[model samples]
Target: LEGADGPGLFNAAQTLRQLVTRESSKGKGSKGDKGSRGFAGVTVRDWPASPVRGITEGFYGDAWSQQERLEQLDFLGRTKQNRYLYASTDDPYRQSSHWRDPYPAAQRAEFRALAERARRNHVTLGWAVSPGQGLCFSSDEDRRALLRKVDAMRALGFGAFQLRFEDVSYSEWHCDEDARTYGSGPKAAARAQAELANAVARHLSARHPGTEPLSVMPTEFYQDGATDYRSALAEKLEQGVQIAWSGVGVVPRTITGGELADARSAFRQHPLVTMDDYPVNDYAQDRIFLGPYRGREPAVASGSAALLSNAMRQPTASRVPLFTAADYAWNPKRYDPEASWEAAIDAVAAGSGTEEAREGAREAVHALAGNDASSLLGGRESAYLRPLLAEFWAAYDAADSDKKSEVKRLRRAADQLLDAFGTMRTARERVPDALEREVRPWLRELARRGEAGEQAVKMLTAQARGDGGAAWDARLALKQLRADGPERGAVVGKGVLADFEKRALETSERWAGVRRKAFGDQTVHGGPTARPDSPAEAAVDGDPDTAYRA
Candidate 1:
């Protein structure tokens, strides 16, 4: 800590804070504890692997409230993140639609407060402007408008600036002025963007001396190899201006050292920074991803100047992954995703300051983490359900006497899971209100599904034993309960229930056919399918007649 400066010093302070939190939580000086009274013999020397490690509120959703943003700044400080980019798509002024508009009095005040908070937390607040949508790269008026916006934000105390030309078409100039000035082509587009970025950097320096170099996110920010536009941009852009890249794809599954090297080469090594889109569940709003920040190799830290995660819309849930991102950015060489995930859970639980609260928070987060619809069968929820499913299926496929035991076991497992959900629902005081609000509906639906799943298992058992009446009763009960359909406003667990319903119905139908064959010359009352008046019933049975009616 003695020699560290800038981000390094911030990282050291965070490490010390973590160490203290860990030690105190161990009851080091408590009356009943017999541990050491002083420090727990912990020694720490730490620095970030990347120079700039932070997050970008750059998702497409309702922007985080001012209070949420303030909390996020504090969270960033706690995790040793040294940078924060304010580039939410929800903000019109931040992007092209209203690029020239100044923040209103109240919004400006919020920005001022945010900037002060960021300064206090030792985080560099970077404001990004996206004017590429309607900009005339050749007009003085456009240039002035762009610089004026930056000047306004600079007056509010944001020293770092980024010009984002992403997601906009550059096939032809938007304005006739630019079309006349620079012909329509990739080279022209790159030249225009690079020149404008250089101009912004120089303007900021001249107006606000000692400001950090400007950052730029190009239109073609992701590529496996260099292109003509990239080469033109590299040739035209200033060396002091940093550039942001989002790997080979916008949301790449992986970022390797070779990709970083390619990006460096493509950008002519203009202090490259990674704008990672992982763990940002905005695109997949139906669920929240609580998994570790992964896919980027450790070597990426050394190859890039910095790594900044683009967070999910749910700020509280995003913390689970951001914590791991911080750990990886701080020490990628020895980073372990699983270890980091455990540490993240502990860190979140530590905030509660009570053993019961910690356990409750951990369980709640663990359940919510499985809400990632993208990896439905691969998360914590699936892990919990998979074993029970295997047991139920094994027992069903076993001897006749074993079916009853297996069915009972499956019902018990379902009840236990439902009970866990009940505990999570009732532990609202223990978990963060934000997280509780974000995940409550999903949990409710999960409990309901557990109930329905147990019932479905029972129905299957009855059908396997040729008890049509029992099977019919169980099916009718499940339909009446409306447990097979997803809960209203629930983003996760839709696929989970849908898959279960499909498999259960298929298995039930197959068993019914086997029963009919065994009885011989029998008539099937429902003729392979039954339609109920209730929409939920239709939903469960996959009845086309009422499937889309609701």
Candidate 2:
């Protein structure tokens, strides 16, 4: 505490709180317990690797409520995050067509209160405006309108502002005035954006006096390599303005040091802040990614000025991944995804302060993680299912006698998973409401899919025993359980049941010939055979060359 400032002191306090909670969970150092009375010899000397480590609510879905934003600020403070970007595409005045309008009385009050809350939490409320959608950039009136909007927010106590030109059409001018003044090309657009940003930065500096550097997100923020527009923007944009880059692609699978270095070179050494688009599951509403933060090289921190995670619409659900992101930004070199994730789970679960609540929260995290489909970072599934899948797969690939035991084990695992889902559905008071709301649908789907998998196992076993009636019943049940694609509420584990049904049918049909022979003279209807020159079968068999030759 001697050398630590506000954030450093806050982080130290959080670490100590976590240490006490952990020890308490282990039944040590409690009121009635016999244990050491002093601190656990743990010392944390922590500081952020990047100057700006935070979350940006710059998504395209439903905006988080003011209460949610306030709660998120508290969570960010607890996790040691120091910045919050209040840019949601759904907000018309903030982005979209109504860029020049001021917030109404009620909304302005909300902003003032939010700014106050942010101050209490030591978080910088970075206000952002997006006028590039239809701004006549060359018009004096248009420039004044943009400045007026920033001025209003500055009055509400926001010391940071971002001019967002991202996702806007900069290939051509918005009006005849811009076209006549700067011509219709990338350089013209870059010049217009640069001038507007420079003006805003200068105005903020002169008026606000100790404001943080201005931030901007250009239209071509994500790139495989630099373009004329990027180069021009880099050269023309004011040196004090920080540029936001989204790695190689808009939603890249990985971000490496090479990509960052290339982007830095493209931007002519201007301050680059990474606008990471992970754990933001808006694009694929069928997924709620509960995976630990991964795919960002440690060198990314040193290569950029700051790192900001783009958050999902569900603020509570986003905590698990954001927690890992906070750790990475604090100390990228020694960041461990698994350790951070486990700690996050513990922190979230222990928030309710009971063993039962902790157990329920852990279960919810597992269920949600099971539904994640991120290819870059792996996700967690129900504890029972993880081992069950392994056992089932191992037995499946083994001899026939081993199959029965594995099948029974798989069925038990499925039953246990269903039971867990049932417990979560009913344990309203034991689990967090947000966690339950976000994870319940997936849990129900998982239960249905588990039933389908159990039926498939039974169908396979019945076919092997020549019991056509039982196999037929199981197959019919499996077909009925097949998912009819993803419904709107079906965000997590979408299409999982359908995939299981398809695989089950394929396995069942593979043994049709033997089943027909077993029940001789019964006129059994075997499924359709592979067509003589069918591409589907050829691809499955890896015989494209042979099929073409034939």
Top lDDT model: 1
Query: What is the per-residue lDDT of model 1 for residues 71-130, given as tens digits with 9 covering 90 to 100?
Result: 999999988887899998898887778989998999999999999999988888889888
| Residue 11, model 2: Cα distance from true site in angstroms | 2.2
Candidate 2 regions with alpha-carbon error over 4 angstroms: 28-39, 373-387, 396-431, 438-440, 450-480, 483-550
C-alpha positional error of residue 364 in candidate 2 after TM-score superposition, expressed in Å: 2.3
Determine the backbone clash count of candidate 1: 0
Clashes (backbone N, CA, C under 3 Å), per candidate, total 0, 1
lDDT of 2 by residue, 1-550 (tens): 5336776776677767667766666775357776543445866666678777889998788899998899999988888888998898788887658888888899899989888988887888988888887788888998888888888998887878888888677565678888888886788889889998999888888878878899889988898677899999999987868999989888887899998888888888888989999788777775677778888898887667778999988788788889989999888999998789777776666566555667776765655554553433444433334554445445444425447765565555445544544543434344577666655655555556556666776776566555767877877777676644433465544444355457657666554431222356442332256454542344343322222222
- What TM-score, to 2 decimals, does candidate 1 have? 0.82
Residue pairs in clash, model 2: 286-491
Error of 2 at 423 (Å): 7.2
